[model samples]
Target chain A: MKKTINIPLGSQHISLLEPVRFKFECENEKIISVDSDVGFVHRGIERACTTKFKFDAIGYVVARVCGLCAITHSLSYTAAVEKLLGGEITKKAKYLRILLLELDRIHSHMLCLSHTCENAGFEAMFMRIMGDRELVMEIQELLTGNRVQFDYINIGGVNRDINSEVAKKIIENLYEVKQRVLGYMDEFTNNWSLSLKFKGIGALSLDDAYMFNAIGPLARASGLNIDVRNEIDYLPFNEVGFAMQTQSEGDINARNIVRLHEILNSILMCENVLSGLPEGAIFTKLKGKPNGEAIVRFEAPRGELMYYVKGNGSAMLERVRIKTPTFASIPVFSHIFVGENYADAPAILASFDPCLSCTAK
Target chain B: MFDLKKYRKKSPWILHYNAGSCNGCDIEILASLSPKYDLERFGVINTGNPKQSDIFLVTGPVTYRSRERLIELYTQMPEPKVVVAVGSCTCTGGVFRDMYNVEDGIDRYIPVDVYIAGCAVSPELIIDGVVKALDILEKKSKEMEKPLKLFKEAISENGVVNRRNVALKVGEVHEEN
Candidate 1:
């Protein structure tokens, strides 16, 4: 008789946001081993990027990889292309790009936190967080035409320019969002179900996070100082009051707390960008096609998003490769699942904020 | 006795499946369910089981691996169901079209009654789509509930007793009603 039993969670589970299958081998209550399949959403995007679309259009094409961090996808691809083309965009465009990126981060983090709450069976809190997330979405719409997939970033610079009236509205919304976030801060810390229950439920220590090469909030929660925003010089992240938020616990609760703090930080950064309002044109026409390969990295809502664009002095590029955050951190995700109870699987998985579309794409 | 078909439209549970989409439209669907959009006011609940669901909300282009599962889910669902294809990718394989692994659209696998067009469908558009789906769902239920009527008496031919006229299909309209 087999003592260990295998249980599968999603190609389509209620708790999961996307279609990624995870098979857990359990003994009694503890998960002994884990096998994950993140290819359910794979549309062969990498192949299409190289073969079908041109280098310029690939920016918009790549943004469709994951909707949560659409800005980061297009921004990363654009940054890579910009490097190859060797053109400098205006200060205003850079500021606008960061503005959208931070706003995307705020909402994406909110979505993750709400999903985590939902997985923990706190449906009311899920509704609450999701409702508040619309504030950020409102700002996103003000900046770009669309709400979710903001095709804001282009190869040279951003697509839209901000006016004073729109900027005023965005600032007002951000302030309201900030106050609400502060309220959430109090609630998340004081609440029993949201933070306390998540404590020690799915823990990954600092050493393990470093060993497994974890990135983004997952690693940051484990007390690791690895943020692509801090490293990259392409964007002026440091100048806009961007600070790294970290927690030593490396559990679901800590990850939640880290995200909350990061949302506040992102709100601050967006505010700073809007207030500063650099004077320059939003778009620049940089001539000459990308001749050589360029690699660029950006901190997406989930984690490190890397884009490699190789062009051969033509409209169509030789290759376009993307390494999404969830794909890079799968090792850490699988490792953390073992030695945890099967019942807490959904909560643990939600805490990681696994974006399967990004991974499979 | 309660009429199930009558009360069914009052609270229609939705089963949302990601056939192979980017998370954009999926999040928008979730957003519509949230308090801001308040899709639940229509008595719509996002459910996991296919059997209990009335509306099948599918996002993303149907990938090769997800095709079988899509068909299986479609078959598993009970009758009087509405399939709403959300986003352009699910409708006509928008951005992911002509990709190696992706199918043209979900309609290739399962029939879509309502198609919501957007790169990532907004909460407003999703609401509109769901409302359209409700109308279709009600129409389907009425069609399903129609009684079977015999046009003529049964006839025995060559020792095979079969009522050819009695085989008037349910919901089929007669010319001289």
Candidate 2:
């Protein structure tokens, strides 16, 4: 008889922020097989996007897909619509969009780092990261007029423009955030207990990462060169100083390190955007309906978020398919869970930062 | 013997479940527990075990697959528990109202004591809702602790009180004139 027992985690658990269930087949301590159910948070957002809301309103509706990456969702959708309508937004609008997107990434990465610490039993570090995360949130609220779900991006361009006072405030806050991130970098690299919990634990190799087509920080951590920011030209990422951060270990520690470096890079990009902002109007009135199918991909906090919008020269869209990052990385997530200890499951899950809402939506 | 009820009222451990809403309210709830909002100051802790919790904080609009688990968690909790529905979608299905897979709100299946409304409710509102749920939890605990009246009233034809009615009010402490 096979002496394996099954342990189920989540759908509703302390470690997970959303609803996702995993059944792990374990022999004593090591997990040998894994199965996951990620449909608990699926609310038919795709179906509703076509039937319930019009094209203009769908920008905000899709933002509800995942609050942590709301800006990315709306930005991709708006970019797709602009592509369809043949509208050319101003350079200033493009820069502002990148600014908000990078700021969102900073706060989101902080949330993931803090959550990883909390799951690994480092309560103090968890509190410290979370407390510092508020600084990014403060800047976000200042720029977008909302903390979590900012419907700042519109069809032609962005909704809000930054004034000099707000710009000054952003630069000051980013400086403070940079200092804090440097301290965290030192701690994450040096702390003995954190290293023990993260290093060589729940690791995925470079081959496995490539085979699974892993994207975002998960791919970057495994030493795979895949970042939508580098590939896409919808946003001027290169001009505003976007760099791809990667690591070789591909473990929880490597993932954290990748996220921290990305945070620093994003902060640099935000500073660059504020200093080199072009002079133009934020919003442009595009006078036409989107009449073709267009696919737009942008980097969400987790990975590459793709939006496929089909329009038939009308107000109501034909189809709005959102391929969220978490949905694509499920295979990679399950692959990493196998051969890991059942007790380290929560920490591993937190490290992946699985957004079931994005997966299910 | 230690007073479990008093301890529960003072330091209510919370069980958070995401049925189907966007993650806005979920993150806000996490933010409230963090240092800035610091809901832990109120003796509230987010726990994984349903049985060990007194206050249940649920986010999402209650999707099809999550309905069973939502009820399972609600039933597994001990008596005198309070359920707080966080977010506009969880309250009344906000933007996802007509979505095919959603069941509108959690109240459709489970009873809700407090509802925090917002596209994604802010941390301040979530803290208020949890504090409000604490009061409701204390009331329910008191209601559970009261002694049974059990006395039989007159069965006069004018206004007779039946056994069924008396059984319904068995443990309730009615106010006397």
Candidate 3:
């Protein structure tokens, strides 16, 4: 019975989490086609950036683009502006930035993992992960003053320096988090229902992953080795020797595995960066104004987030453009969800941790 | 008869719906579930499917485009439903009250059981509001047997004539009389 079943979720859907519209064309509980309509909550964020904001204030403005990936957005925006200014940040600042970014990864992955577990009917798993996840938030609050959006990274350097007092807590917190997270991984992987539901569903091959320019763990999970952290020299990530994990399955389980592996790697990177924390000036005084255009990339919680900024020697920026990971993931979503059942759709979409604010902004 | 306390204690699932607000409410709502607040101790969890959720945590002021969808989602939810308006945005439109696309609040479209107020609403307050809702849910479950009869008797005992006059006036105005 291949009859048409129209399922329109969002625009005000209870379970959507984000404010977006989705029209699903299902045939006997199997989603045949999916149409997503964004821009309902678009506040002209990019336009607001160029017209109403100055270059210095845009760091904070862009940071508000996505609450979850605010650190990534702010860092990318500041990096672009810093490049235009041609001022050099200290090695310590770079390491600190990378450390904060990895912390963000840990926070974001835990969020996604919790959400996915909830969607998969593993309420206990979700709650347990969220419990352990608070350690990362506490560590973030300890270091950056804010739990989610750390406004620490500014134009040339970081706002808050990591002192020995906070550093010890952060180190201890990371160890506790890693231990708790290992238990979570054991439950998530060993559970037959979770493994069966996630494995081989929403299978996206490496060719398609690369064709659609999938970056971060989403791309790496499908055997497409394209992590900006390893590939780019924007920061001193390579100095700590961060390893990228990949899987050939390219399914929902593969994505989960990639995120899990990445979170582990992120913890390691943070540990290494914190251990080798250099001593120098966290901030440098910029005498003149920025006069050129620059583009910068950073691996956000989702994937590679790219930012472009052009300053016209004035306090106001001439232009500011942001390409978030979710924006890139949109093209890949259609390809991955083509033949999957409707039940698997939410988990698959959630595996990518689609942040609509990040995409729209 | 089902044990109301046992069921209420076991199934306190919430499904978060963003009508149209800043992401402040969304992050705060998720924060309550995370370890800092430790909401799971109360057996409260967030589910992605409304079919499985007992409470609907509606955020943001309902927009013009979102009204139809809001009603649709409201109807989709099964009985014994509790809709909690979390944040000033959902309760009274917050700062987005003047926007052309926005309705005043989600209550204008669907019924709301409790209102959790704040510019964005903190996780601690959200937990308090949920606790209050659980109290309401507990009361409602006990009174479900004679809800209509009890309402009718109370209306008759407490000035039925005035209520009838008001209803007649509204009916006459709408040409339903």
Candidate 4:
């Protein structure tokens, strides 16, 4: 006869950055079932977007959805509004937008990687990655005024422009970040203890990935070819050398490798955007209230982010719906936890890099 | 024997909880603990268990669903604790003020000793707030260590001995004033 035991993680755990609760049913050491509560951080942001903030200000408001993916949120909302208003932004602004978007991806992915290391009990690795992450953060601060919530993208285009001095600094920083990432890649692939914790743990197969409709690194690690960056033409991702990174193992290590490779790819794209930036104005003025409905999709650091905006010829929006990546990946997250050991639960959860704020919002 | 109070003052473990706001403040807090900010230099460690933590660092505006957990964590923490609210939203419900699901701020559920103000408070500000919290924690610890005294004359007309009414009378030896 077998007896089942239940263990609860989070709502507030050392491993989790946000409020998310997971109830795991274990038979001995193997998890039999997983139940997750992701609504703890929900502050009714969707309702507030329509009711509290106006169409012009909603861009910045939506940035509050998730700080790690603030640029993607604001970018998607602005793109939707621009679609409704029928505005064409400048090419330079487009390049700058891509620059910030990729920069955001690099830092966000670094944070996730460091967090995974910490969860796997590699504290030194966590500190190293986090310390190096400040290089990207410094470049972001130089580009935009603030560090985390840049509020860089506005209605028609971008809020800030990059000069030669900032451009040089960005390139230098990217070089340092690239070298650091290569070192991390070596450690992740060859380190025995890290492999013991990460290798073959929390594996999500390609079939299950597709069946659960996984997106971003979670899906790509499982060998599924789905990325909003490749699918969407709103940004010149292909022009700036955006390449999809994937891994076949689909375990914690595969996810880390995918993130590391994506960080490299994002750095290359940022370098490309900075080097061959088009000569034009960063911001353009659009002349009227947005009318009608528009849907926009962009790839955030974690996964795909979608924004649906419905507006009338008034100050207020009729409706605004935000579909965040982690929100969609929760089902898959639950599914992956089924067969994993109870001790590996935190590492597995960190590997997914679930953003509860985005989910609850 | 090592003095636990002195050790606690030197190294105060922290318990971080996200009540409801965007993850901006939470990430900033995490960044501060990392090497760049090096919050650990001040002997600060982020602990998961509430009972072992000395300083409670809370982010985000308290939401309806999280209010109970927020209070639960606060209650589980041992006495002589300090609660630091990190972020504009957590300080006073900055942007999420009038939202239906939000409870304005964490202070609605528990007392906030230090308030760091910013849409997303930077790591520098977080370090400063924690430093200030250490002082407050030390003071609270000292206050908790003081013994209470009973005074019969401090009883009110309702036959209840009010501590606030007695106030300095118990803690102090009065000369004939």
Q: TM-score per candidate, in order?
A: 0.95, 0.95, 0.81, 0.94
Q: Relative to the unseen true structure, what is the C-alpha lDDT of residue A15 in candidate 2, on a scale of 0 to 100?
A: 84
For model 1, the stretches where C-alpha displacement exceeds 4 angstroms are B151-177
* lDDT (Cα, tens digit) per residue for candidate 1, span A234-289: 98999999898999989998899999999999989988998887897989999999
Superior by TM-score: candidate 1 or candidate 2 = 1
Model 4 chain B, poorest ten-residue lDDT window? Answer: B168-177
lDDT comparing candidate 4 with the true structure: 0.90
Please tell me which model should have the higher DockQ, number 1 or number 4: 1
Model 4 deviation from native, Cα RMSD in Å: 4.9
lDDT of 4 by residue, A169-190 (tens): 9999999999999999999999
lDDT of 4 at A14: 85
Comparing 3 and 4 by TM-score, which wins?
A: 4
When sorted by DockQ, best at the front, the candidate numbers are 1, 2, 4, 3
Across A228-344, the per-residue lDDT of candidate 2 in tens digits comes to 899989889999898889999999999999999999999999999998999989888998888989999998999999889899999999998889999899999899999999989
Error of 1 at B104 (Å): 0.4
Best by TM-score: 1
TM-score of chain A of each: 0.98, 0.99, 0.96, 0.99
Clash pairs, candidate 3, are: none
lDDT of 3 at A109: 90
Q: Residue A179: error of model 3 in Å?
A: 2.2
Model 2 chain B worst lDDT run, 10 consecutive residues: B168-177
Model 1: colliding residue pairs: none
lDDT of every predicted structure (CA atoms): 0.90, 0.90, 0.78, 0.90
